[model samples]
Target: MKTILVIGTYDTKDDELHYICQRIADMGGQVLSMDVSVLGDPSAPTDLSKHQVAEAGGASIRQAIDAGDENAAMQIMARGAAALTAQLYADGKIDGMLALGGTMGTDLALDCAQALPLGVPKYVVSTVSFSPLIPADRLAPDIQMILWAGGLYGLNSVCKSSLSQAAGAVLGAAMAVEAPVSTRPVIGMTSLGSSCLKYMKHLRDPLQERGFEVAVFHATGMGGMAFESLAQQGYFAAVMDFALPELGNLMVGSVVHSGPERLTRAGAAGTPQIVAPGCADLVDYAGWQDIPAAYTDRPFHAHNRLIKSAALSGDERRALVRDIVARLERANAPVHVLMPKGGVEEWDREGGEAHDPQALAAMADEMEKTVKAPLGLTMLDAHINDAAFADAALAVLDGWIADGTVKLG
Candidate 1:
């Protein structure tokens, strides 16, 4: 009953593409083939042919061939393929998508997969499945990718196994996947783990009782990426974006970062945001890698084998706060800053490894100096981990709810 759109260069991978279509049919799933070949024709014809694909991208097949550059030609195809894929999903013709490629194919496949919305199933069987060649920004947040092992040449047992699994995976995902649902207005919140920042535990139940669903995201790299993606899509009614280490990570030249457009997207979409300087003083980096030369002497905490945190100096904190305040200034919706003077993260408080009272004070002073009128700023005499911090945040939300800046469910 499910429909899977199978996309590939049918001119080159005729046998493999057909075999995969047969498997989908054998499993009672309907298949729609899209041929993205530039030079050669498919053995027969596809539901969407190379000429159609080229025209969808606003050119002809001859244009691609005339360009005489593989990369440039494929980019044209990529654009067309993405547009047609989005059109197909919009028409309800596809419940899922399956794509196969080497480097060039994977590149186009990524574009097509990203064309679909967040929840519709997308699977890519690629030679460079998890390689650094594919940047994280180009990938759909929920895309599934499998390595096309031993699939360089003609069909073999290994390649067939991968192809068969990809077919089943896309079909199963389309049949069984449950779309994101909320009966109440959703509050998208962000913060660190319970040990470092504990407001999520205290705030979630109270927000639920107020007839709002609170979705808490860990402020690590990928988690922030997901939060920002959803926020840009207008998913959040209101947001409490408290966990902010990713911003610091990005500014501090750390590779463990979300995209460059992290903090600004929610506000650009006009989502009311309650901002906080939570964990703004720390930059996270991969624990397995050597510490960056700039922060070698600074306080460091190895949270786990996968990640570690490094605190900034007094002057660095000051500059970071100024930059953060500047970002908050550009919000189209109402924005407020809740600064916990005692500490941002748990370790930055008393009796912790990263306790540095002077640095916290320096950051607070800079925030006070930088934040101005029309943008709300509140300095709490508490750590972000304290119950009082949660209470203050709740009070802010209550005020917004009463004023109708945040609509009630």
Candidate 2:
């Protein structure tokens, strides 16, 4: 029998959740309501009591609720709910999950829903659904439904229609989910077109050989954000950032800014990381036609007919170094920042049109000065594509692996 796991703070959202559960049961679907409230008792009866859910979450539910404020209690209850849901699914009990709430309830419910593996349809009906801040809709590879403008106990007609539609959608999705055959840890690689193939050749295969499935993301503004989001989603065990061209775009007011939290996710999540200066020296523009007047005199290299690259100037290089170091400094997990001194981009290499020794030196000096973390700094005197550069990166990773800086599992 397919059991639909309906989760909510029964104490706070009893009326709405009870309404949804009744509809699910009436639709001939098995409904299991899981109460996620740290404080008061649930208004609706549930398959799993608050104490049970808290136990499943590896915490004392009653204690957490009594000790914390409303916000803190919600966070605690969300963790418990997610842990309980994960256990239920692992035990082959939950077939699907549905959540109904405004922003706070939506946040807690989705936190639990995401615990289900990809393809297990998760739905959130929220009033804030129209102005969705949840990136799960856009980012997660999983199919997440966000039903907008879900009113509170509205006119019977409107409420019935919306609830019926949402319930049916969630039920259908749960029935269709394919069972996961494996739970391979995803490795996210941030690359540019110029260096993507190289990642496959040098890093991806090596990582797979060491038992990891690789997912490569472009270093464009959107691509970097998506890759980091996946890391925060706990979808990736490690991050290999090979193309960092977005730094130059961010500094130059280009359309390619990767936002403020570009390289900071893995560190915050304690995901093992390998950072690089790959494509760090240049910024790509639409074409030579869009090059700023001040940069018109600088050397330019045509990557293709449509894209042109220009190496950073001395001051820009220094700023890039500081930004890069700041990110590296914040990492709590095993981190290694490798600098390919021969050049950070193809054009900056010897005999390339965008080569600028002055800019390169300034960048390196800033790194030496700014990156004072013991053993965090790895300056390799080789071209990025050189076998030596690859060897150095692998060596740093291997050292971290041996030293237990990164969890071997």
Candidate 3:
């Protein structure tokens, strides 16, 4: 039978945790309960006690209780829980894991969930699943979450319904997952919506035909963060970074910033990368968000009710190009830059809303002046979504692979 590790502060959430445990067991699974409580004794029986967890975190339970600061004690427990959970996973004692908590519990659970590798079954029942309090960069790529509604301190029909669904989901996922017998070299690619998707569509099948599994990440803020995190973990064999609107958003202090270290990881990890300014002509804001005072007069395009895009001014475009060059300059691996003279995105094409030849020229000039040797720069007459541009990108990547610069499986 598969064993699902149930984690929570059993001292306070005993009743709810107990219900979920019974549900999992009734569904023909075993439960390994871990208590992460820092203050009081656990009301429910635990397979791993708080004292054991605290010790693993480099502190004693006695030290945590006597620390006198709730935040400090919880941090200590979080560190310990993360360590113990990872060790359990490595020991093959865990098939999947589930956790339930409010704000504090969610924080601790996130730490535990991130300890496990990607593709593991990790789920959290939290009061704040996508809330602003949870940093997007800290979220694991495949972790799933259910918002804990109506279940504060005790179990009710409402809470039980959600809990039962969560139990079934995690169990089904764990059972259905088949471990891979052989691995294929993975190529990570990034693209936005319709504006920058043509390159991805064109490149995916060809890369696979050349013996690679292409992983495409939507260039939304969270998607970029997950890509960078996986890259830092040495997950990609090569990277085709086609969208960089998130980096521009960061420079303008927009809420859509992926993270501070957006374009630096593949270079630091020595992964061959093909970089492009796919959407560097625009920055994104929420559909309902008012334009910032500094950019109120710039060109704007509302994609839908939830997203809006703003065209970058010539100066802004220059800054964006410099930022891209600086990151590529630090690459320890082969890095190639591709510039499309026609336009970078659908909206920036001829007779399009974001079209501005002067701005594009400014960006190209800065790239040519700043990008130095050891890093290759190519300027193409084709538009970003044109077949010719796609061919050029594929050629570069294929050459690198043939020359042993990009290792294949």
The order by descending TM-score is 3, 1, 2
> Residue 370 deviation, candidate 1, in Å?
1.4
Best by TM-score: 3
Off by over 4 Å in 2: 1-182, 194-197, 286-289, 304-307
Q: After superposition, how far is residue 147 of candidate 3 from its true place, in Å?
A: 0.8
Cα distance off (Å), candidate 2, residue 96:
11
- For model 3, how does the per-residue alpha-carbon lDDT over 22-123 read when each residue is reduced to its tens digit? 999999999999999987777755999999999998999989988888888988999999999999999999988999999989999999988988878999
- Badly placed stretches (over 4 Å) of model 1 are none
lDDT computed for candidate 2: 0.72
Off by over 4 Å in 3: 179-182
Clashing pairs in 1: none
Q: 1 or 2, which is superior by TM-score? A: 1
Positional deviation of residue 221's Cα in model 2 after best superposition, in angstroms? 1.8
Candidate 2 lDDT, tens digit per residue, 70-120? Answer: 676677777888888888889988787887777677778767766776667
